[model samples]
Target chain A: MIRSVFFVSDGTGITAETLGHTLLTQFEQVSFQQMSLPFVNTDDKVEWAVQRINRAAESDGVKPLVFSTLIDSQLRTHLVKCNGVVFDFFETFTGAMEKELGVTAQRVAGRSHGMGNVRAYSERIDALHYAIQNDDGATTRDYPMADVVVMGVSRAGKTPTCMYLALTYGVRAANYPLADDDFERGSLPAVLEPYRHKLFGLTVDPERLHQIRKERRRDSRYASMEQCLMEVRAVERLFKRERIPFFNITQRSIEEISAQLMQQAGLTRRI
Target chain B: MIRSVFFVSDGTGITAETLGHTLLTQFEQVSFQQMSLPFVNTDDKVEWAVQRINRAAESDGVKPLVFSTLIDSQLRTHLVKCNGVVFDFFETFTGAMEKELGVTAQRVAGRSHGMGNVRAYSERIDALHYAIQNDDGATTRDYPMADVVVMGVSRAGKTPTCMYLALTYGVRAANYPLADDDFERGSLPAVLEPYRHKLFGLTVDPERLHQIRKERRRDSRYASMEQCLMEVRAVERLFKRERIPFFNITQRSIEEISAQLMQQAGLTRRI
Candidate 1:
């Protein structure tokens, strides 16, 4: 049966989406049509949102599940009557927190993920620029300033890892593509010598790497299984020889890759 | 006084971080030192994590705050004994969710942000590749396939918006930079004409755009306040004239920008 789920929030709705998705994943049997309704702050907006949720409930003959983080009581009251199973995330926990800590919440929207701190925003933007500027070994001029440099064979999950680290943690991450030249020489690139300490390697299963490469450029030497195996083998050998920490991304997600990399590298998130 | 906050989880700890930070932000009176400890599944790891929390509590002279998403009973028991005020996330809501949904949780870690579905993982990776290939007015080769195309002047937050849409929602988002050449002509670029329906504009405050540009290229005419104002005004006029939805990114986070764009574009996340 198809079910409807709404992540309703007065701000970005990211927290509602993240938590709601996590909770929904537990019920693997149910197929959910999920949508996010962000910036639902006003009475008029909440009334409109309620009608939308109620319509979904009527059409499905089941109450749509709403996971909400709206802090305003008036807006929340409107949601409670939306003919849906409302999960009041902020109200549920914030009450307990106030009682436990003996301090009331400020009850403001967007404080969690807003532009509250200009410095933090700039740090993230700076990290984003760093990730783009140094992408795929484009430049090594600022290697010394990089928090970490990820090296991997093409399409082996390097670029996204760097981007995730930069965007999520405000970490200055750069990634380099471990090309055929490096594999042929059986050594690290000369440019990476000075910043060897900042190096983190990524290796993927040869079969998976082949699958990924085939998507980008079909029926080429780059997408061949033999080439994938050779590059992965060379990278692993170099990682072992240099004692640089590395990971295999064949079965891991970007979050897992970045978390493990940060742990292994002892790089605390700048944010 | 400095207080330490720990985001402890069985998975990547992102959920804990997001929720915990939201709670902490309410208490603006205190300064927090935040750290994430992900993949805390084993009893040994939990024990070690407890020690770290205790050390932080000892050093800070104020009980540390532990925001945990550990689903395992054994881990939760260990965490309760730690020298901190524990906020158990899963325990707080999972029982209620179980009763409401009539399904017991599987208690799986990393399901929220993991490689649970191979198809979803491949989709995300594929979209990411598409975004990188079609970034910054790079090409019109695959414009027909893009879920959305973000257009704006340089440093108007086009690249990250495309990347976020791609990475988070598995939307094949391409970005085109609306350069001085496109503006002086007083119309849309020739490449973007066919994909006008997929276009979303990002406009930043001229001052912020100037600051951002100055960082990229200091002391250049491109970074001047006059140049920034001229470009922003022209882009805004174009957005209005063409009836393309647009946003000002001066005070919004990337999360905010992406969520609003998804809403405006009516783009359902592919994942």
Candidate 2:
């Protein structure tokens, strides 16, 4: 049985630790641990980690499973003497991104985590996720309670992102829908008008929306490819006319999107 | 075979979707999907959920496996007609808590996840699992970018709780030893001094600490009952003179401790 697991990251160990903790919840028997060597992008940290692993092997007889997000291979080699298994997140993701984006990611500048600001994107994305899943009509009552609200059409990943916000930030998030009918009428949804400043928008390509919707409703008009295209164009136009600041969520993971919004919204880096 | 799974809490479909998506990250073949009924909490939402489940069953021609968390039993029965196995967390936990705490729980709260604040707690503890396993010092500069340090004798759950804080709040946490030698010195390890306000103390009864420590290190003076009492006494006196707000993490899980600490420190929640 796995007694322990470690999460390592090349940058901040933030993503690795979060995902690691999440995975550990499924099992009750194992203990979880984390250590981040932020500049693990360096040879020094890698050698240091390997030395620690060597010492652990000498004393702590237990085998530990290491999950890492190091973008460098040399550091991983340093940990070779550690008496356990090692896993990397940036390793797999870089390969995937290289294949998909058709280019290697340039070493980022001065640690953005792909971000320039903190709370703005954090708070907004959190609010957006909150809005998408506000099923109890709770969003209506949540206005005063809300730090932000996100509005958009179907399959825009409103709910999941919002929940991430609420779960992560303790920010009360409320999302509103800009349905086909509402779009046709050409204005923000009635529920959203009163909270315009708090109302953020999410947009995605129609192709993506249709593909997601198709998984649920096979032949329905809402799920059809052509209709999805029409909806996207309509929603995009509506958001533009309304001057709502929106994001194209095609390339971003839920994390990146929320992070970006938090930066945009001026929320501090509580992350 | 299970094609997909749904993990939901209360009326928000988005929160369930966030969990479902994260769970999906752990698997390669299962099709992870999500649905929500955010406005319907109390008894009404349960029946509505059952109707939706039934409809999904008809469309998929498979009994959908639902990991749901609806607190109302009357509504849970409605889901029984759906041709799938439904797992409700509250259904299990409420009974367990009622038995353990000797009281009934009222009001279904956020995401209605049976984990609730424990959800945050689990996330933190899980991070600790990763920390020990990985152990590269550079983690200090990573996403958690933790500067605050926690120090106490072992088995006080310093590792797990730090991971929880790091992953949950993005606090880069580092812990140092407060062993006999350090105690004799009557001062914190030199490295922890620069981050004093960020320094939070975690102190528990030595007897309890000894019992827990014994599981990891057998028969050592550090793990003996008498020694534990001495250390506990010394640390309490040290903390009082030095003035560190600490919690006795004797009986509580990492989550309970984390919740108290987060509230105490006035730290903002991290998604």
Candidate 3:
């Protein structure tokens, strides 16, 4: 039987996986199960979660370990009634934060630990970049289901994120490149017409583009600052003309980009 | 330019990338040139790290985001000399532990974090299983790198992991079925012999195996508890005799296994 049950905040199952994973490495003898309860702040949901935690603890030969981060008292009491060891962040941080912050967490942040959500956003962005690098643009005809298709000059992080959506969140992501000819012609590729509902453009600062391009080629025509700026301007106009949502990669990290894209595309975690 | 430097640690650079990518998501105006120094805990590498960090902070007009688990001092001091923000766990934990545990971390643990050569162990076990699952055993030639290979018996959590790794890691992780015949044969498939290094395996509890397989194939030879127990016994013996160091997948969550396999394969943050 597994020895521990780890409950994390809503949408942070992956973060719990990463942290719980490290903790599990230290204690090799025990098994762990992840219980992801999103939006546990509400009174009704917290009560339901408490019942589940109690059942998991009492159902077996030995009471299991409950390692949790439940912020609500409704959930905390249910946890207290359970017949096992309960290691909770709420227990650890509640009194401390109450003393230090001068106001309770409820008065400040709603069931905090959005840090995990931020981490998941990073994982999705990593996947997006991975997807972009792997997109063989020649054959990317008619793959559906990306809430948004991120188009940018080469080396802009796009495909990794699409794959992140597919790999981490089961979102189908397809990427198209803005080739030199397409840039010169000032247009997206022909095949992107049908999926225009999900098209977005990414452009970076010309100087950074120059540096990134310099890594692959030394002073090539495409890597030239003038050429990069020209392309960036063209791409921006295309995004404006085509009315596709677009963002500058210069001032934003992938997480910021992914969140904005998710918001623009009306996407959220399935959980 | 930013004022802080950040360091994230993984047993290897994988954890570094995971967190580094996440931490960068916070600000839109922030731009930090991300650098990852792999295998930096050794003594000689410290000065070189310090030089680079200082150079970045001063010359690049950007605070360095150094994602490292530099357990060794010579390397960390390199950054210590620089005037930037340095946030690192290896520094945090080891420094805390040195004061709290009353012993130097180097004395407490030989190294800070690693799946402690688990990649090597996983690969060794996985190699034989990969050999067993090959359908093209009839062919007579040098084995091509496996298009797909997986290790783990039924209900062993190998299938989902294999699929995830294949789909996400872009690794074709083909899992082998470990029935009595495969075990009794006393050797992996001939096709796998050529690609032995590419084999991988997963192991789990017999009762769990029965419960999982029961749902899919009831009243069959494969689903029988007795059969599951016998096959597990035989395959384990075979693994022992073959000198394959295996992991007990029964207790491990999928992310841990996938992370371990990716680390074992040296495929962290490749894109």
Tens digits of per-residue lDDT, candidate 2, A133-246, equal: 363234486576666676777768665456556535445666666677876798776777777777677888888788768866889998998888887888888888988888
- Residue pairs with colliding backbones in model 1 are none
Alpha-carbon deviation at B246 in model 3, angstroms: 4.3
For candidate 3, give the docking quality class from DockQ: incorrect
Query: What shift in Å separates residue A257 of candidate 3 from its native position after superposition?
Result: 2.7
Candidate 1, A83-129: lDDT as tens digits: 99898888877877676566788888778878868899889878987
**What TM value does model 1 have?**
0.97
Off by over 4 Å in 2: A1-139, A269-271, B1-271
Error of 1 at A171 (Å): 0.9
Off by over 4 Å in 1: none
lDDT of 3 by residue, A144-216 (tens): 6345566877766564445435444434456677867876677667778877887777777888778768866
Worst 10 residues of 1 chain A by lDDT: A94-103
- lDDT for model 2: 0.56
User: Residue by residue across B1-271, what tens digits does model 2's lDDT show?
Assistant: 3343544444433334443333233333344344434434556555666667777767766666575555556656665555656654445334543342234555344322223354453344334333433232324333234545666766566755665565456454666557787679887656555666766778888776776678658898768898888888888877777777786876554444655566565565443
Clashing pairs counted in every model: 0, 50, 32
Q: Write the per-residue lDDT of candidate 3 for residues B1-271, one digit (tens) a residue.
A: 4434444332334445444444343332353455554445545445566666777667766556565554445555664665545555345434432342233444221122332443442342233233323322323242465544554565565545654554333454555655556776887755556556666666778887787678668999889999888878877877676655466555454555665566454443211
DockQ of each: 0.72, 0.02, 0.04
lDDT of each: 0.87, 0.56, 0.53
C-alpha positional error of residue A219 in candidate 1 after TM-score superposition, expressed in Å: 2.8
